[model samples]
Each structure stands twice: as structure tokens, then as C-alpha cells.
Target: MYRFRPRVLVDVSNIDMSTSMLGYPISAPIMIAPTAMHKLAHPKGEIATAKAAAACNTIMIVSFMSTCTIEEVASSCNAVRFLQIYVYKRRDVTAQIVKRAEKAGFKAIVLTVDVPRLGRREADIKNKMISPQLKNFEGLVSTEVRPNEGSGVEAFASSAFDASLSWKDIEWLRSITKLPILVKGLLTREDALKAVEAGVDGIVVSNHGARQLDYSPATITVLEEVVHAVKGRIPVLLDGGVRRGTDVFKALALGAQAVLIGRPIVYGLAAKGEDGVKKVIDMLKNEFEITMALSGCPTIDDVTRNHVRTENERIKSML
Candidate 1:
């Protein structure tokens, strides 16, 4: 017989995880990251996730490559929606998406700028995984619209990214939508400042979930530099490896106005459905509030530099 040691309780006393994005107040600092196929995860896909976000009073960014069309998802969601757009071979095809998103009442257009070409996905490649062809584009293309010939999702993605697009294209995107514009895939302080100078409304400090560049720095690593570079000229948001409440707390402490969630939400969607997605969002909010409280943060402001010691410790260890 052995004596049991008493467990030490962690203190999470006063926490405030409430935050906002693009002038919309959200219950927490989390947004669903846009992934291409929702149908593969669940039958309802974007529609289910949108409903889930609405139920939790959170925001969600719908993908351009979503299984359902913009109107379909927008009709089901009470949550604020942002459209994530990628460049297509033709300007008209890209413009059509923006117009449709605007007509469907999306509040902003997030132009993803890093993928001029699709990066190889080994898991998808190995399994010979094929994304289901979108019903929406069935009659829109030519007589022979090839779907699975290239590789997998990567091949499909390669067909969409426009290498010809430049800063001029960004200006054109701004001209097309009355909604605010946010440039995603910005990884450097210089590019962040350039976006501000380009007259965009916000910058999302992302690396396309580390799917694009294999050796790229994590979104959290360069967040401070981007935030400080922007100097409050525009709101800065982050995404990638942010699954915990402490992750959200750390982001705010590092100066991100809010954070975006990607793969975890997809995982939840895969496991359950709309309900699973909602549960994931709620779990994040609850954890964020708890982390804030335990860290002695009563409000968003209370999660300051002093509250994040691990980051500092890591930096010191690097030196």
C-alpha cells in the first residue's frame, strides 16, 4: 500500500476571452479556417459548419472551393461571413466569385496570395485521393473539364492559382468589392507594411497552414513582427497550430487582434457534423476563457507580454 500524493490544482481565476474581428463582435477570438471540401468531412459541409458558428455566435470564413455554393452556405448561416478567394486562370472566373460572394452578403473578401503553384501533399498523393467535383461548376466549363488528371487536391489547386497576378490584381480586387479586403499569406514585416501601403484593411499572418512551404516559420513565430510593423494601421489576425485556449491567449498577448482556426474545426466536422463543429468552437471559447482566468487576465488587455512566459523562454533558449 502506498500513500497517494495530493494533486496540485492550477489557478485559472479571472479570464476574459471575448474579442472582435473586422468590426464584428465575436464571443471569442476564433474564426473557422477555410478548407476546400466540407462534403468529404460531412454531407452538409460548409452549410453545417456555418450553422454551427451561428449557434455559437462566432464568425466563419467560407472557402471559394467549398462543396456548396456561396448562396447555399450564406442562406444557412446567421454568423458573419467572409469570402476566401483564389485567383483562377481567367480574371472573369475570379471576378465572378467575388460578385457572387458580395451578392450573397459576405462582409469581406480575403484574397489568398501565396499559392502561385500547389505544394505537394504526400498523404493525398499516396492514397490517390480525389476531391469530389463541385456541382456548381459542372456546366460552367468547357466540353472536357479534367478533374483528377493532375495529382489530387494539389492538381486541382494548381489549375486555380494565377502566377500572372500582381499588386495590380490586388487593386482590381479592391475595386470589385465594396466589402473590406484582407490579404492572407503575409509572412514578413516588409510585406505586412506593403499591404498597409497598398491600402488594404487587414492582414492575416498565415502560411496557408504550413501547407505551402515545408520549412516556413510557424504563424506564431512571426506574428509579433507583423503586428508591430503594421503599428495598428490595420487589424492583424493569425492562423495555424492554434488549437488550445492558451494558444488564443498567447496570440492576443503577442498583439494579434484575433486568431483563426483551421484543421481542428475540420477534424471536429469530420468526427460529428454541424454539431461537432459547434462543439469545437464552444470548447475553444470555454478553454480560452479558462486560460485567461487562470493566467490572471480579467479581460483581453490583461493577456499581455507578462502573461506569456513560454514564448520569452523559447526566445532566450534560442540565443
Candidate 2:
């Protein structure tokens, strides 16, 4: 569902994929999205992931449910990192986590907004998977449930996520931290406008990896809508189903300041630890650069809306 108009007369030898987010300079626009319990993927867990991100000179968003503590992950590498938080039913717990992240040098807080209740992941249910103890919250709080029937992740989310979460909490989060805040899990133009009005530093267009709600529009499909509603006032990022460099290019053209890769990083870590992660990043970087050159973009700035067309646009043209 991607269409690009190629230009043959452009320089292909030099292309820059570097871009800034939240005033931090990253080597490329690609970044690691927050995935919980990385220890399931590798022995070193988030520590290995952190080291890889540092080596690649990109950002990594550490999940609040990470297998490693914020301090442990921060100590593993000096990579620019963000912390993804699910506001717990307990406000104090949320505040403490934010404080720990800020103190540990996280540059931003990615507040996931879509999950008030854990979505039914049928695969996890069928596999009878149990989430590992969240290292970040270990000893600070207990999410232990009384022998749940489904995955521990579902149980934990059900117990911890504040079902009463509302827009006013955004201001409360802003008050508690000096770090920039990005509201993740928004997919609509109306919500995008609301996020901007709520004074978030950025917005992430996501559908909880389409695990939260079935039949939701793909992130790429709604990226332009959110971007348009934001009106250039704040950065809009996208996550979900980005496995190829062409996918990255498509998201960027539609107005994602950058895209986040979730499953690929996990797959890489599970396959070969830190080196695998670096390899995955390197592959994406190379392919994205090639995409840039082939599409007539010599730099990230050169990649604009005109560089690509959506399925709707193509169909309209035919009509």
C-alpha cells in the first residue's frame, strides 16, 4: 500500500538518516520500542539491548515492566533512553517510577495511554505464558496475583493499570517531572489534537501493536490523520508492523518524525543477543538509506509527503 515516485537525476551516493527527537541527537530516526521482560529474549536482557543501542547511537525506550531495573539498564550503557510508563492505579507508584527514570538519566517519559485493561492475547493464553517478575518494580510494589489462569502480563496489567486514567493526568505528569513527555498509543486525529492541547512534547501513533483492540486501523494507515491534526505543533511518532526499511520510509513520508521497532529487536535479541540487535539496526539503516537515495531524498529533511503516496491516493488518481 506504498507508492513512491522515483527521480533518476538525484545523487545517490550520500544520504543522511540522522534526526533529532526531544532535542536529543540520534544517529538515525529509527529507535527501539519498549518491550517488557526482555530477559525472556536473552540472558543479559535489557542490559544487552542498552549496550547495542549505545553502539548504534540511537535511543531505546525502556518499559516500566522491564526485566531489568532502570538503574541497571542505565548503568549498562550511556545510550540516550526513554522510559515507558503505564500509570498504575496508585499515583504514588507512578510518580516514584518517573522520579527513578529521571534520576537515572532517562531523557523522556513515554506514557502509554491505550491500555486501561490488558488486551486478550490469545496466543499467550493458549501457551499459558506467565510474565516474569518485573525487575523495575521488584521490592517496590507487588503485582503478584493469586494463580491467574492467563498470562502473568495480563494479570499484572489488570491489577496495576489505573482504569480511571484521564486527560488531566497529563498535566499531573508534567508537574512531577522535568523530562519531556510523549503520549503513546493514540491513533486518531481527534486524540492527536487533544494530546497537543494537553501540552505533551510528542505523540506516538500506535494501536498497542494491534494486540489491545482487534480490527483497529494499522498505524501507518492513521499516521497521516494524526499528523494532520497535530498541525506541526508537536512531533508524531509511529510504532507497529514496521519490519522493513521501506515501511520506515513510508511512515516518514506520511509525517512520522521517526518509527519504533518492537518485535524485530526482540527477535534479534533472542537470536543472537547484543550483536543480533546491532545487526538488525544496521540492516534497517542500510535499507533505509537505500530507500532514501532511490526515492530522491538526499537527507531526512528531503523526505517529504511528496515522496510517497498512499493506497487511497493511488485509487483516487485512477478514478
Candidate 3:
């Protein structure tokens, strides 16, 4: 039997999604994840996204290979910004980026550990997608050699990736940044505990937005274990496949301190620059607030394992 829709407007009286990330207060815990090639999405690139973040009163994690430089985006908006660094073969090059981020007043350093090698994307490859040669790098690095000169994005990723990195380098990174350092790819409980023990500020429960390992479990599935491993030692954030406000509610219920939104925001930016991104953020926030109210969750703490059920029997039992 199908029930008729409620005639009255749904009341979102219980929406209180405010939270903090690295001591910075956000209107909500939702954040914009760092992705490469903002120029592909909008003419203003990171500047546009930064503006959206400012408008929504959210945070933005700017990628290392961004078309726009860190200073450019930082100056354009006062949105809480974190620098996402891709560890390279040359330690000095990595150090330069960290120093630059520090000078640019980035509040945190997000080290992406998932991509020891860049994963293959069929669309980018078939299109022969050479990312319109990073315009910002002109006076920076020698543009003589593009990241990929041959086959596709995958081949480019293969050559550009640095698999030789080790955890020991985290200490080296800590030495460079008084700003909080967050490891952005810890998935397993063991790695989560390691991050906690490393004395790092936080961990982002991620699978590189599922762009790295195609078959890896969705980020939401592994979030609880990571949160349990941290055991309140530090914050744990989720980033990947987050497309709606309900996704935020689900993530909060599963113990994610916050969630990071990616590609969708880019699409929004592509559609209409800053205003479009703001609308996307607004849509998610409104949906999350409504979901929390409908589910009888009035605050972040009101959301918990009790509000969630899983098809996985063992997992359901544990919850």
C-alpha cells in the first residue's frame, strides 16, 4: 500500500549541524574537497570555489596542482582553506609547497596518501585529456615537460606518482608546519590508529574519492572503524560520493566528524561559477537539516549508530 505525501510542509526545526574542523568553526561540518584542474570547471577556478565556500560559510581544501595558485584563492576569500599536498619524488619540491602554503596562511596541510600512483580514468584517457597546461605554474616550475606527454591521464599518473614515500616523512612534514597537519587517506582501523599515534591533528576517511582504486569499498562503509580506532583522539572526516544532504546525515550517524564534497561542486561551478557552487552547498545543507529533523536528530550528538541499519549482518550487529 502506498501512502499519500504529507500535505503540510515538512518542518526543519531541529537543524543544528554546526561543528569545528581543526579549531575552526564551520556553520556545518561539510567541506569542499581538493581536486585538480579547477580551470576545467570554471574560468576563475579555485577562486570561484573559494568564493562559494565563503558564501556558504564552509571550508575549501585547495589541491597542489591547482590551476590557480594558493595565494590567489586565499586573497579572494576568507573561507577556511587547507592546502592539499601531493608528495613528490623530490623532497625539496614537497618542502617548497609546504613553505608556500604556510606563507599563504593556509590553516592546515592535507597530505593525500591514497595516490601512491594515480588511478586510471577511462573518460580522461579516451579524450586524450591533457589538463590545459597549469597556467599558474608559468614562473613556478619549468613547464618544459608536461605531467603527461604521451598516452593519457593514467600514463601521466604512472610517471608522476611517487610510491617510495614512507610514514617517516610525516615527521618531516610536521617539522615544516606549525599549522595542523591532516592525513587524508587513512581507511583501515590500523592506519587510523597509526595516524592518532603519529600525533597528527586529523584524518580524512577517503579512497581518493574512489578515483584511485575502482573496486575499493565506498568510504561510508569503513568510516566507523576509522572513527573507533581514533577513539576521540582526533577528528575524522569523510570525503567521497557525497552528493546530497541526506548523505551528510548518514555520515554523521556513522561517526564521521564531518564530510567533504568534491566533483559535484565542480559541476556546480562549471554551471555558474561561485553562485552555482553556493547553490549546491545550500542544497546539501538544507537537505541534511531536513533529514536530521525528520529522523529526530536535533544535534550532531543526537545522530549515532542507533539511527542507522546495515544490510551487512555482522556490521549491523556491531552497531
Candidate 4:
């Protein structure tokens, strides 16, 4: 899905992956995507992930549905963290959580705009999976599964997520906090423009891990379109199917400020808890550094559009 033009004559030493996102300096452009129920992977859960992120000097976006509370995750370590929020059916609930995130020192509010309803995750359905007790809402709200629902998560999402959520809510969220609001789940140039018009601080081009819409285009395919639409108005981020350093390099070349990894971190946590998570992050960083070197990019800024080609471009050249 990607092609790179390497510069063998260029210096390969001193490659720097350090970059800043929303005013926070990170050691690398790689960040941990907000995935739910870390407890499902390890007993330490988000607490362990937070520690790993801090150790790596990267950002960690905490899920609203996290097994650990915002406060607990914040206090876990010194990592720069953002909170991913899903608007609940109750406006008050959304506001309360935003306030809590701000108070807990979360750097941004990653407002997920994709899921008005839960997606048909057949795997979860076959397993009859139930979500862990959403610890963020532990004392504040209680969500129970209705009888005969395929999974507890589905039932909870159906009852809790506000289907009527719209562009106007961006203004509502702005009125509540001064923290940067990054809108996630945009896959089109049209919606990307709308997000900028709505005054979001950033945009995350994602497909909810391809779990929401069955036939949606891959995030990488649409990333450049969304980036061109925004035209550097805000930081454009991508999160989906980024499994390698080359993937991250490809994303940056196409115009993403950074990329996020979800399932890999989960797998790492399950394998070795905090240490495992740290290892995963370290491996990605090392691989990306190697990629940058091979591609003749001594710095993150050097990884530009000229470094890579897309399938369409490749086909055009051959023709």
C-alpha cells in the first residue's frame, strides 16, 4: 500500500522522532489510542498503560469507558494524557465527565463523533461479551445490561450514547472547557471541513477501528483527502491498522501529524503488563527510527510527501 524512494547517499545517523501535539512535546509521533477495558487485558489495566506511556515520553489518550477513573489514570504517572469522550444520552453526564477530565489534568478532550450506536461486532456477539464495569462512571452513573441483548456493551451503548449528537455539540463542549477539543471519526473531506468550521482544535481521521461501519474506506486511503481539506488548519491524526514503523512513516508522508496504535498495546499489556507495553512502544520507536534512516529522513520533518507514493500514483507512473 506504500512505496518509498530511499536516498542512499544521505547520512543515516541522528534521526529524531520527537514531535509536539496540541502543545505537548512527545518523544515520538506514536501515541497510545484510547481502547476500552484495559482490565480485559491485564489486572493493572490503564494504570499500567499510563506508566508505560510516561516512561516512553509519549501521549496516552484515556477512554471514557476506561476501567480506571480519570483521576486514577492521571495519577498513575507523568505521561501527557488526553481523554476520549462519547456523548451520553444525558447532556449533564457528558459535561460532568469533561469537567472531571479537565480537573484531572487531561491535556485534551478527544470527542469521538463516529458511533451514534454500537457497531455489529460479530466476534463479541459470538462470545456474548460484556464490558467491564466502566470505572470512570463508577460512583456517578450505573449502566446495566438489558435481558437478551447480544452483549452488555451493545446494550449499554444503545441506552447511553446520544444518537442525536451533532455539530452544535462542539460549541457546547467548547463552552464547558478551555482544553483543546480534537474531533475523532472523520473519514471524508466534507466532514473534515465541517470539523474545522466547528472550531475543533484537531481532527483524528479514524474508522472506530473498522468496528463501526462494515465497508468504510480504510483510514489511510482517505487520510490525504481529509488532510488536504483541512489544509493545516489543525493537527490531522490517524488511528487504524498502523502496525509498523513504515506504516507510521507512510502516514506522516501522506500528511498526518501523528498516528495512534490500539490493539498492539492491548496485546503488549496482556503479554507482560507494563513492561510489555513499554517494550511495544520501544519497538515501534526503534523500527520507525530505522525506517527514517533507510528512507533518508534524519528528522521527522524530513519525512515528507516526496518520500513516499500511493498505489494510484504508482499506477499512473507505470501507465
Candidate 5:
């Protein structure tokens, strides 16, 4: 949906893709987005993904529904990790997991605000897709309702998730943990502003991978709006539909602090192991570096809004 405005002869000899999020320096602006049931993708699950993130010198947001227990993933590697969560119906259930995450050395909490209820996935409905029991809530809560239904995700969310969750709960979460807080699943400038007003440390502009609400605006298309709304008060990140090196550059040009990868790395994990995951990251990093060199952006800060042109801008030029 966007094109680059490359600058020629910009001394492309050295390019650096490194950037930091909430004061932690990472090797690049690419972070691993939370995707659940890594074991279903590979036997190693989140453990392998954690190790891979450490190897890549980036962060991985562990899914609230991860198959690997928080403690297991925490002990598996020294990668900087953030825990993504959904507020459960049982208040203490969510509180206890957040406490465990903090005690286990997690750096931040990414509260997923989009899925108070599960979305309509026709494929899941057709094939009877079942959500694996979450290892994080093993003793605190259960997802073992009737067991045979493919709509287990629906069953679990209805029973465990608090659809009543709202902005006021941000204060409730902050009361329990000293870690920085980031609210994910916000797609509009309005909610983006609310996240900042709610005292969130960062905001992730996402549409739940376009799986939560169909025909929702693509995350990339709406990224600039959220970024503009935040007005640099907090770091704004984007996830969904990010599949290429150019995609990363496009997000940076539009004002994203970073871009998170979801499916590609998981595909890597399912195909090989940790090495496969690393390979996917390496390829993206390499391609992004080339994009930087070609586009006259030798550093992350060098990428600016002027470096890209949206279709609307192109049409406006004709006028």
C-alpha cells in the first residue's frame, strides 16, 4: 500500500538496524509477536522461541495462551521477555500470573485488549480447531470443558476472560506490578489516546492479526493515525501483515518504533527448530539492512515520514 522514496549516493557503506524499546537496546526493531501453542508448531514450543529470541538479540512477547509454562520459558533462556495477558474472569487468576511473570524476570506486561471474546474463525469452526490447555494457568484455572469440541477457545474465553475489562483496570494492573505496561490490540487514534491517558508505557497498533474482527483496517494503514495520536508520548509498535523487509521499513517511515513478526518465525519454528527461527530473523534483518542502504537510511532514526509515499499522497500529487 506504500512505496519508498529512495535517495541516491547517501553513503550506504554502513547501516545499523539496532533500536531500543522502553530503554532496552535490541539488535533491531523487529520483535517476536506472541503466537500461542508453539508446541503445536514444534515440540519445543516457547522454549525454543525464547532461545531463538536471545540468539537474535531481540524481545519475544510470550502469548497468554502459550503451551510452555512461564517458569519453563523463563528458565530456558536469558532472552528479554514480556508477558502478554488477557484479564480472566477470576481477578486473582490474572494477578497471580502477572506476579509470577515479574518474579520470573519478565521485563514488561502486554495486556491484549482486543479479545474479551473469541472471534469467528470459519476454518477453526470447519475443522473443529481446539485450543491446547494453557500451561501458564495450569493450577490456577482450567480449559478442560468437555474436551472434544473444536470451539474450546470460545468455551475457555467465555468462562475465564473478563469481558467487562476496561480502561480503569489499567490502574488495577499497575497497582500489582512495577514493570512497564504496554496495551496491545488498539487500532484507532481514540483508543491510542486512551492508552496514553491510562498511563501505559507503550501501545501496539494491532487488529488481532485481522482474525478478531474481519475487515478491520489493516494495521499498517492505520499505524500513522495511532502514531500521530500518541504524539511521541509513548513508543508505538505495529503488528499484522508484516511479511517483508520493505514492510519493516514502511512501518518505520510511518512512525512505528518497531515491527513485530508473528507467522513467519512460527513457520520457521515448525519447519526446523531454533535454527529455523533464527534463519527467519536473519533473512528479514538482512533484507531490511539492504532496504536501509538503498533508501538512504543508514540508521533507524534516518527513516522518516518523507522516506515513504502512501497511495493517497500519490493521488494528491496528480491534483
Candidate 6:
């Protein structure tokens, strides 16, 4: 679906894919994206995912709805962790989570700016999917109760999540914690520029995996626009549909500092728990390394926008 401009006869005998996020060094630029209810995927849940991140030497944005507690995941391993959160109607609860993440040694707070309300997922509607008992909110919010009618997840999120969340609320989020704030879910350059203006540390170009709205542009398609807007002011990351090393390569060529993987992580966890997750990460890392070598890139910085050519560009060039 995409073409890479590989330069031959350039020595890439020792390719390096190592990079850092918010000053935290990682073995590779690949990170584990937050997906709710990892427990449903594996018995170990976020703990297992955290361990995989440790083994792979990368970051994992633990979901706010993780089955395992923050302290439990933190003590499980020395993996670099960040917490992904949605603003709750109860601002106190959101503030409490920020405090807990900091206390538990999380390196950053990834504020997912989308999902003001749950999207209408048809599969969930058909299955009446019951979300796992959210352990983190056990005492803080009632999770034992499940709606007998429709999707319990939709009901719970509607009642708990702050639908009124807006760009101005970034200031309120900043007031709560000192951790670096990376706003996720920007699909436009305007919003990316606004995020930079708001003083957020980084931006993640995403559309909540395109489940939030119909006909939304893919995150990768809009990555260059967002990156062009930011103009290297901060790191730009992408997460969604990244299944291989080439996907990571294409993203980097488009200006993504790194990419976070979502479904692949859960797939691995569902298959073999911690080891499965590691296999997924290792596969991507190895693939990315090979891709870099073939492309004459010896390091992360060597990956540039010119390295890739999208189909649209190809057609235009022919014309």
C-alpha cells in the first residue's frame, strides 16, 4: 500500500532503533498503547503487559480502566509506564488518579482528548458486551452493577466521563500534576497547533482508532499535517493499525517520533500472556531494524519524510 525509497550501497551493518520519550530512553520507538480491560485478554492483565514492556525496554501507557491497581503494576516490574486517562465528571477522581500515577512512578500522564462520549460500536450493541469489573474504581465508583439492558460500558462511561471536556480544560489538567502531559486524539493541524500553544508536552495523532466517528481520516494520513503544524516543537506519536515493522517505518517517515500498538498487544496477551506480548514487540522491533538497514538508516534520526511515498503521491508524480 506504500512505497519506501531504499538507498542501496549505504552501510547499515549496525542499525539502531533506540529512542526516548519525554527524556525516558527506550530500546525502540515502539510503545504499547492503552487498551481497556486487558484482564479480559489475559489473567495477568496490565501486569503482564507491563512486564512485556519491561522485557522489550519500551513504554506502555496503562489504561485508566486497567484491572490491576497502579501500585501493583508499578511493583510488578521496572518498566517505564505512563497513565492514559479520560476526564471524569468528578474532577476530584481525575485529580486523584494523577496523584496516584505520580506516586506509583509513572513517567507521564497521557490525556486522551477524544471520547467525550462512547461511540456507537455496533458489535457491542449486538453482543451486549459486559465490561470487566473495573478494579481501579472499586471503592471510588460502583462497578459491580451492570446494566441488564444494553452495553454496560456505554452506560458506565456516559455517567462517569466528562462530556463537557474541551481545550480550555487542559489548564485544569496541568494544575493537577507535574507529569509531562501528552494530548492524544488530534486529527487536525489546527488542533495540533492549539495543543502546542496550550503548552502540552507532546501530541498523539489519532482518531480513537477510527471508532469514534464515521469517515474519519486515518491517523497516518494526517500525521504529516500535524507534524508540520507543530514544527518539531514537541514529539508527535501515532497509534492505530500498526501491525508490523514496516508500519512503524512508514509512520516514522511521516514524522511520527514513535508509535503505540493497541490490538496486536491484546492479541499477543490473549494468546500467551506475557511471552506473547513480548513476541509481538520483538517481532516489530526486529522488523523495524531490518527495514532501517534496507533503507540505509543507521538510527532513528535517519528516518525522514522522504523515505516513504504514499500511493497518492505516486499517482500525482505520474500525472
Q: What tens digits encode model 3's per-residue C-alpha lDDT throughout 254-306?
A: 78889999988999999999999999999999888777777777777777776
Global lDDT of each model? 0.81, 0.90, 0.81, 0.92, 0.92, 0.91
The clash tally of candidate 3 reads 0
Native-vs-model 2 lDDT? Answer: 0.90
Give one clash count per candidate, in the order shown. 5, 0, 0, 0, 0, 0
Q: Candidate 1 residues 1-319, lDDT tens each?
A: 1111111253445455667888898888888877877898999989999999888878889987788988999899678999898878877777877898889899899989888887777776777667676754555532122445445667666665687877767788877778899989999999998899899999999999887889999988899899999999999999888988778878888889888898989998999999899888888888888766666667786666655655447568589
TM-score of 3: 0.89
Superposed by TM-score, candidate 5 places the C-alpha of residue 216 at a distance from the truth, in angstroms, of: 0.4
Q: How close is every model to the real structure, measured as TM-score? A: 0.89, 0.97, 0.89, 0.97, 0.97, 0.97
Candidate 4, 1-319: lDDT as tens digits: 7789777878877888999998899999999999998998999999999999999999999999898888999888899999999999888888999999999899999999999998999887877777766877876667656447577778788888999999999999999999999999999999999999999999999999999998999999999999999999999999999999999999999999999999999999999999999999999999999999999999999989988886798889898
Which sections of candidate 6 miss by over 4 Å? 315-319
- List runs of model 3 lying over 4 Å from the truth: 1-14, 139-152, 312-319
Which runs in model 4 stand beyond 4 Å of their true positions?
none
TM-score of 5: 0.97
Candidate 5 backbone overlaps, count:
0
Report per-prediction Cα RMSD to one decimal.
Answer: 5.3, 1.4, 4.2, 1.2, 1.2, 1.3
